[model samples]
Target: MATPPDWDRNATWGGSNGGAGGSRTPLRQAFSSLSKSSGKKTAQSLSASGSTTPAHPASRSQSPAPEQGDGKPTVASDAGLADDLDNKAKLSLSRQSSVSNKSGAGSAAGRDAGAATAPKGDGEEDTPLQRALKNPYHRPLPGHPGNLTTSQAEALLELTQLLLKDGALHDPEKEPPSYQETQLLRFLRARSFNVEAARTMYLKSEAWKKEFELDRLCEEFIFEEEEAVAACGWRMYFHKVDKLGRPIFIQDLSNLDTTKLLQTTTPERIIKKFAVTLELAVRHRYEACTLSSGRWVDDNMMVVNVEGLGLSTFWTMKDQLQQLLGVLDQNFPELSGRVQIIGAPFMFSAIWSLLKGWLPAATVEKVDIAGSGYLPLILKYVRKEDWPKHLGGECCCSGATATGSDGATPAKGKSDGCLHSDEGPWDKDLVVGASPRPS
Candidate 1:
């Protein structure tokens, strides 16, 4: 075969160690060379074992026994393999730490997040006057106050002027008038009498000028008229009497016809009247009395008597009375002519039936008058004298001591007689004696 080409020889040994016709090195020589080149004690020890070469110390310590059928080395038993895995894990942990440091995040972020979510306070700040306005119980503002705004101030002044004007025509107490009254007069110069007209008309009349100044008189009239309206309304409420002696009627003026009389009339007229009447009624309540005898006896059942009317105030309140009369004519025509205006009384009678028990018999008798119809008679007798003799004496007639025509004495020794006498003992005696004498 002309000796096979050198290529055939190379192929026989897989192109490295020759096989068949290729050149070859002994396995022991190769192992010896590998052991020498490695220079490891374990490799040298394994090389010395020869037979099949003992495991190296590093390999024996790290590698597990290979599986019977598998050709791959066990990863758990491989020393290099475990070291590679550990090195990769350490590299990954280092990278994570570096990233966290660069970002700069911590616990402070949590606190800020909580503060952004927290509720909000009532808004009740206001001035004393403002608060008063909001409160239901606060009193209404007067005609003027320094703190009021310009518009409010103007309105107040106008209202004050109106009230003063009304007072001039109706209020007697505001006699001689005031600066406010003068301003009101100027305002009403054409409609009502003014100071110049009064001077022209009354300056010549000595009597008129002495008794009254025209301007003052006119003002008095206006003031009185206003006061009367107020007084009427007030009396109706405090005395619990209506325009017709019925129960009080506190109705609104909205429904009532107040437009017919004076163009200047207003709801305030009624309100002011009601207020004044209440004050006066309370003051005069104890002094109020009804007339018992006369042409007009019982005619004015609920009418306050003249004694209780306090006439000294009449001149001051004359304008008020006229205004009241005007109001009465406008609203309650029935009482316009019949109602008798009166003044407050000087004294009041306070009677207590229980107190009678404490009084002496004679004193009770002296207080009691004859033929004067019960209470009226007693009052008259008491008015006439300082104190009755019977009140200090043993006579137990109580206040019924007025003598009868007969000589017979009043009944005694009976509780009913001591308290209330059914038939007047004096009456019986008088009747008995008046009877025809036994002929």
Candidate 2:
């Protein structure tokens, strides 16, 4: 809840470090796991972290290539390509224009099967990036102006009236309840300023809130096993505010012992705990931050440490991750500030290549993947003093995986004071003595 550090204003989605005004939607899309451009395939994706690629070629394949037709890469003869182009060009101009129309892009009636598969985003003015940010809860939505532009507000009000007429909201003052301007905007933004979509989404979320008794959950849901989970290398801890007053959530998935995790808990139980934590964070921590700092704080900054991950870990954790991220994406849209994946192993590319299609494009764009050399980038959002010592900082979180020792989790016990990041400076930036993000 402390005032956001001045460095917060420097958070930029575009390429420029600190103070950039553009959104890197184009670049992010270009690097999407589905995108096979050589530039994206290379280690260049890690360049944003300010790390240099090793001189010796360390990567095998940049990404997983698609299954080929008949075990051979399809060969397109130059002559055949030229003929196809000529035939297309010879068509009537009107015919070509009609083919170009977005509505007809996927229609096989008049276009070649290959042609019909043209990029899906061509006619849409909003990029995948823009759509993802429509309901932004982060720093003024990267480049877009004030949260929920005036026009968006009007659209949301229209939705309210529709719901009112439908009797979905019976009492203007009591029933269906009133929400903050920003909260109302969040629903509208999540649905891309579309009134009906927002209406439906808002109604469903309201129903979910009531059905789950979220109020009571927030009051009573005790994460009794949090410390136990932390000891298993599956830490989900919220330490302190970022430069922007958004809470920092650290989840270490890199060093997990899958066998131990399975024995300790089932996938469903683990997911339930995560959902409860996220709900509490969104509903409580966010409000507390906004109240204390007198600034809107709904989104959170995520630091995913994927160090020491291997195929075994991926197979074990895939379902859990898919479920967690899926809920966060569709149900809790626009709640991500800056998502950084540090210490990513080469093996991660395989999983991502397969998983990218399943994730929302906007969410995919927000992830910044880096090799072990992500410390500098992490410091951009959190001061070095507050960083975990295992990752090259002064603070030594009590439960961090043993560096020199094997990946076995340390014993369960109360952490040393430094492991709790809440103790970190709040009145001002902790520029000197380091503080641990919570254990």
Which candidate comes out best when scored by lDDT? 2
Root-mean-square deviation (CA) per prediction:
57.0, 19.2
Ten contiguous residues minimizing lDDT sum, candidate 2: 47-56
- Model 1 scores what on Cα lDDT? 0.24
Give candidate 1 misplaced runs (Cα > 4 Å).
1-235, 238-301, 305-311, 335-439
Tens digit of per-residue lDDT, candidate 2, span 192-286: 56778767876776666566555454445555555566567676666665555466777777687877777777776665566566755543455
lDDT of 1 at 115: 17
lDDT of 1 by residue, 350-403 (tens): 212332344333223323212212223222212212112222212233344433
**Residue 436 miss distance in model 2 (angstroms):** 13
TM-score of each: 0.16, 0.56
Poorest lDDT segment (10 consecutive residues) of candidate 1: 290-299
